[model samples]
Target: MALRTRAVLVHRRTELDELLDRHATRGQAEFFLRTRGRTLADVEARHEAATSARSAVAASVPSDWALAEVERTDLDRFLFAPEDVVLVVGQDGLVANVAKYLDRQLVVGVDPEPGTNLGVLVRHDVGDVAEIIGSLAAPRAGAGEGPFSAVRCDELTMVSARLDDGQELRAVNELFLGHPSHQSARYVLGADGGAERQSSSGLIVSTGTGATGWCASIAHDRGGRRLPGPTDRALAWFVREAWPSPVTGVTMTEGVLGRGGELVVTAQSDRLVVFGDGMEADRLEVSWGQEVRVGVAERRLRLL
Candidate 1:
């Protein structure tokens, strides 16, 4: 029997037309276009390239596949198809767009962390909330089917007092604690019972993926030499110069920590912001002697 397959085309419009004209083997396949600026010919060329790539990938599989591009408003329509396999293209934006349309347990091709727009959208849509680094003492069990079945963080470590059953957590490029409004924040950094008070513009904790982006960018601006390892190279280039790094480098699970661990945070500030996977979580007031818990979530993004 011929396997039935469905593919979604996500790219610039000119590219979409070209892909449909060239790679579309049958009329049943769907093509979703995401074109911005380009002439008709340019779009056609892009489509041709994309379609050919898809065909090559599909040929190895046993299932029959169709192709199409999705409209912003019609995501729900495509998502409802239980048998359709949606393929997203482009860079970071592709991951974000794909998450919005996914209601089922579909895999994507990207990293799973807060810094990523896709991670934020997935966390928000699924309703998995993270607390301060010290607050995750026990997993809270509740009724009802969760929006997401699992949450997974790649190349991240968690340090928490305790973790609850079914409440998943993970670390990413880094963890940032600061106020959006420019202000000096005070915090204590240490493991176990020992801690010290330090004041600085802000504090940020980064994993390997976050090293290159905002974290690395800030280091370069401050005249800090590049740190070695895959951890520092991932998102280091994406970091902006305006933001500063954490004052004290408190060692938690340094040197290749796994998915689940804990990083204790105690700080003094009227308002504190916690960023994971590179997105903001609900804000909290960091008072003296108060602890923020951190951990990894169970959901993982399926990247194509």
Candidate 2:
């Protein structure tokens, strides 16, 4: 039997959707916004644009192809198959949100508004989606071309943190090891060169994909560091505000992790946690005496 071709459309909640959720009605939301000198007009327009883009992409799917829609909040619960083609429709962050859950599936990022080039991930317009879908649905598999063979893509490196207990977490951007409440965290940080007991707010290990975010900020604050490119098999890490005391030192603050290299953190506090791409709700809890190793993952994002 031929392999089943599937398309999974991923999206996030719009500002208007959040407003309605909080205020319970458009009238109330409008009233509250009006007091702040803002109208619902802009929010409604963006919401309509996002919805239109999602609908258009959905309509482009071939009737013979199976289709599924996943909201950002449901990514963890959604089960993705190997043959799924992921079309992330939203800002660039939406792409990062879904990247951790995928396993070599081709991704097509759709910009809902499409005017500005703010996104490195969301590169295509809504009109471009139809052609991509058509290309995927064409009868070309017998000629040694797969469903998504016509499109071009780049494989981006990702970061993974494996705990001593065997649990693991991955991120397309960066991984954060810290306390849940942003309080000072205590850990023993180790690398190939050396190790140190640190007391600080937390630590961050960033991929080149994540350098655009917190990693870039940290680099800027520290007079810049040579960050790896998106396709580079490397990672960068930093310890945030490490404290110096009689028992702890602030020597190991930052470094670049090459391919096959690892950064190890042994938790010394009860509430130490690890999260990726700002998704603190989905996190790994490491207790005292537990160790987590950070490294470049073997799996890469196949982005179209």
TM-score each candidate: 0.41, 0.95
RMSD of each: 14.2, 1.9
Scanning candidate 2 in windows of ten residues, the lowest lDDT window is: 141-150
- Report the CA-based lDDT of candidate 2 relative to the real structure: 0.90
Clashes of each: 85, 0
**lDDT (Cα) of model 1:** 0.40
Model 2 superposed RMSD (Cα) = 1.9
Model 2 residue 283 lDDT score: 91
Which is the leading candidate under lDDT? 2
* Candidate 1, 247-297: lDDT as tens digits: 543232122223443345575666655544443432334555566654332
TM-score, candidate 2, is 0.95
**lDDT of all the models against the reference?**
0.40, 0.90
Candidate 2 local lDDT, 171-254, one digit each (tens) = 999999988898999989999869899999899999999998899999999988888889999999988988999999999999
- Measured with C-alpha atoms, the lDDT of residue 32 in candidate 1 is 31
